[model samples]
Target: MKKVFGILFVAGMVAFASCTSATEATEDAAAAVDSAATAVDSAATAVVDSAATVVDSAAAAVK
Candidate 1:
């Protein structure tokens, strides 16, 4: 009886550990996606700013 109980406890612990690992992996993936989105947003903002600067320079040259 004791041996069966011990085996069950160990099995339960292993199952919980695997679930925790999977949760952590999912969180990590979400974080990576968020980071990538931030990078893309920043790059898009930079492009817009650069285009504005070019337009301003052209206007100045024309004036």
Candidate 2:
């Protein structure tokens, strides 16, 4: 009976560790995705502004 109890206790602790680690991994993944999305959005805005500037320069040259 004592051996069974010890085994059960160890199993419970292992299960808890797995749950916490998984949750932390999920949170980390979400943060990385959010950071990447922000970077992409900023890049898109920069490209649009650059395109507009090019168009303006061309028009001025034509005039």
Candidates in order have lDDT scores of: 0.95, 0.96
Give the runs in model 1 whose Cα sits over 4 Å from its true position: 1-21
Per-residue CA lDDT of model 1 for 1-63, tens digit only, reads 999999999999999988765777889999999999999999999999999999999999999
Worst 10 residues of 2 by lDDT: 17-26
Model 2 residue 52 lDDT? Answer: 100
lDDT of 2 by residue, 1-63 (tens): 999999999999999988765777889999999999999999999999999999999999999
Q: Which ten contiguous residues of candidate 1 have the minimum total lDDT?
A: 17-26
Clashes of each: 0, 0
Model 1 residue 18 CA deviation (Å) reads 9.6
lDDT score of residue 47 within candidate 2: 100
